[model samples]
Target: MKLSSFLQYLDALGLLDLIVKLKLRNSILLVIMCHEIGKNVYYEEGIPTKLFEAELRYLLKLRFTFLPLCEALEIIEEEPERPHRIAVLTFDDAYKGVYENALPIMLKHGMRGTIYPVAGFVERSVAHWAVQIGFILRNMKTPVKIKLESLDTSLYINDEYDKRIALKTLLNMLPRMDVDEINSVIQCLTQFLDRELLHEIQELHERTMMNKEQLKEMAELGFEIGGHGYWHVGLTNISRERVRQEIESSLNFVNAFMSSSVCKLRTFAYPYGLYDDNVIGVLKELGFHAAVTMKPIVNKANNLKLYEIGRLSPYRFGLMTLSSFKVQLMRVYT
Candidate 1:
């Protein structure tokens, strides 16, 4: 059985909760990585607001203490005599869904987490390139035929299956290219798809990212407004100097907007959960206190690496379920 199904089976037999009680101890921290937080049809990983609330409620019932990213790092670094069963929520890419949908729910539950915005996206009011791709795939007409000259591949989308395959193929190929080439591919797609790329961008802009005002409001509300890079490109794929520019520009934008109270602990989530020695070095040089990756392992406080912190995401688990979520949470104690 798949893990989620297995967890469901355990739930059916009344063993899941028992297992949770037995295994979920208060000894480690669980950092959750998320993106959009509403019914983002174009964004698959985007969790609906109701489901997010359910997950939060489930975590609370299991007695996990929600910690801000900064406080969680402090506890791990200090190695306190007693550690709370900690969970930190980190939203990547500053989707407006977070401010419009996720924040109210989080506020109602007395929880605070971290938000990472792409400085360029927020400033330009544009969706991430991935979101732009999603918009094209979802809105393009049937029987679509397009050529990706960058990848030397052509897509023929006649039905939903073909559309999905085309999307997966493009998504897989796009990240491997540098930002300039990716832009070229997008421009090519806009032309071949015969769609008004600018109009689609405008449509997605409101759904994709928060503006200056919303970001400021979240910062004032005590959220750790962190950086996801200036352009949301993979830092590891760029030149070291370009990486420095991205990090410095991102930090400058975040630092300028975040309150001193929130800026006291500067944290970052890698744009694609990617980094290397050079990336880490740049982060340290730029004074980032902690950085999180897409790794799905729970953090062991005693052996934590501040700059190389790991995080978990529901997207990797196939499906979102309370039972599956509980099993994922059990990683903290295991």
Candidate 2:
């Protein structure tokens, strides 16, 4: 079996937790990354609000210190010898579910996290193309053939399993394609679906992202509202000028609402966890203090990189189970 798979097997047998605790040590930080938070079938991969609270309680039971992303990074940089289990809770996409559902549980725990909002998404009331695609596939009611000229491929989706495969196939191609190409694929797929469903995109977006007022409230509440790019596109694939514009636009949007807040930390999370050295340079030029990536690893004090900080997702293989979660912590923390 693969190493992670093997570890998960042990975790299922309730054997991994003891091993993790035995080898657990101080001086490491776990930067946990999350996305949508609600019980929406269309967003099947999203962590449910109840499960999120359970995860928080699990970490608290383990005596993990939850802090904002900036504070956690500062500690990793300046206090390498601190004896505690440190964690930074972060959410990407600024989904409405976060404000509607996750906020109450977090408030109850006295916890704070970083909120990475896609500026264009919040400003224009448009869902990211990927999110729209997900909604389309999840809500598919009949068999359909999706043709992608860009990829020179076609997928015949009939059942839930087939839909899952097609969704995975398209998402896998997103990182390699530019913004236009990704949008093109989405358009083609949506056209294949019913026209009535096309109108749902706007409704989906409105339900998917936080409105300006909600975002302002989050900032005022002291959550680190960080940038996730204006277009939510991968910066590494775009021109340097475009990259600068994307990052700058996002920062400006965040700063506009955060003007009244005391939290002024400038941070970013790479869209789709994709970035290169050039992207990092643009972020630095744009005055961002640090950026987080989707890489799953424990961040030790000595090895923390400001621009390439690694983050772990709560969902494993697009689903979150407490057993799998414990195993993930074990694999990284030990």
Candidate 3:
């Protein structure tokens, strides 16, 4: 067996718990990152509701204290003891599933999480381009040939797997293309699918993102709302001026919908977890408390930078079994 599979087997057999118990006594802060939480339709970006609940229950059983990102930062700084294993739950892309499917589960456990919304998608009630691309490709009835003139690449999506591969390729290429160019590619692909069929797919795909009222309601429920950029564009690929606009606009948009007593737009999560020194400087200038990245590791308090805080994705936790999650927790500290 491969090394990773062997390690997973060890985790599944519950052997990794002994390592965690023996080696990791010191307090460590873990920030868990998730994109969506609902029934997995595309199976590309979400953890099913049952699996998510299981993970939360497992974490609570371990006595890991869940905190808001801002509060977690304060505790990590002020509390020298770090008495408990600290965890901060954050959901990216602000999908409606988070508020609908995930919120009730979190509330059952008396837990709260941070959500970062793509301002444009939230306001317009549309999926992010990346999501739209996936939905279109996944729901396509037959093989379709399309050429991305901007990237000078052509693809034929023949089946579900081909659709997945095409979606991945488009996602990697979109961040590097101009906004208009990206839209052109999407428009070109849409032409190959029937309009009514696309509409049918959208209706069946009930995982649309949260609307403004839902966002406001979530803020009232003690969930922190953060910015995920205006257009969900990669900051590093865009011009610095565009980066400033994206940051300022998204924060302002979310702040307008939030009550200061419940939540404020104080944090930012990089779109696609892509950033640069200029992006960090922009966030600092905008007076953000902290920013999160998609990095997969537990953060150490002593040498953490507010602007570039790393987060661990659920896939790193091994979503199939609780033992893998435990192993991931230990693996981070070890």
TM-score for all predictions? 0.91, 0.87, 0.89
- Reference-based lDDT, residue 70, model 3: 67
> Across residues 1-334, which tens digit of lDDT does each residue of candidate 2 receive?
7655775687777686776576456566788888788746353457877778888998888788888787676666666666647878898888778899888888888888889988988888888677788888887776888778899998999899998898888777776777678778877877776788778887977777788888788777777888999888878778889899999999898778667455556889999898988999888887899999888877775566888888877856544676667756754632
Ranking by lDDT: 2, 1, 3
TM value for model 1: 0.91
Task: Please list the C-alpha lDDT of all candidates, in the order they appear.
Answer: 0.79, 0.79, 0.76
Candidate 1 clashing pairs, residues 3+ apart or interchain: none
Better of 1 and 2 by TM-score: 1
Model 3, 1-334: lDDT tens digits are: 9656877789777788777666456666778888778744353657778878888987776677877786677766787555547778998887778888999998888888788888877766667677677777876777778887777989987887888788888888877765677778878888877777767545432456777788788777777888889888878998889999999998788677556425333888998889989999998898777899887777776557777788876655344555556656665531
Model 1: per-residue Cα lDDT over 1-334, one tens digit each = 8777777788899787787677655466778988888757473767867778888997888788787798777766666667657889998888878888989998998998888889988887777888888777776778878877777888898888887887788777754677788888878767655555557566777766788888888877878888788887878888999999999999999788655444377898987788999999999999888899887788776667888788877543677666666666556422
Candidate 2 residue 25 Cα shift, in angstroms, is 1.4
- Please report how far candidate 2 places residue 272 from its true position, in Å: 1.4
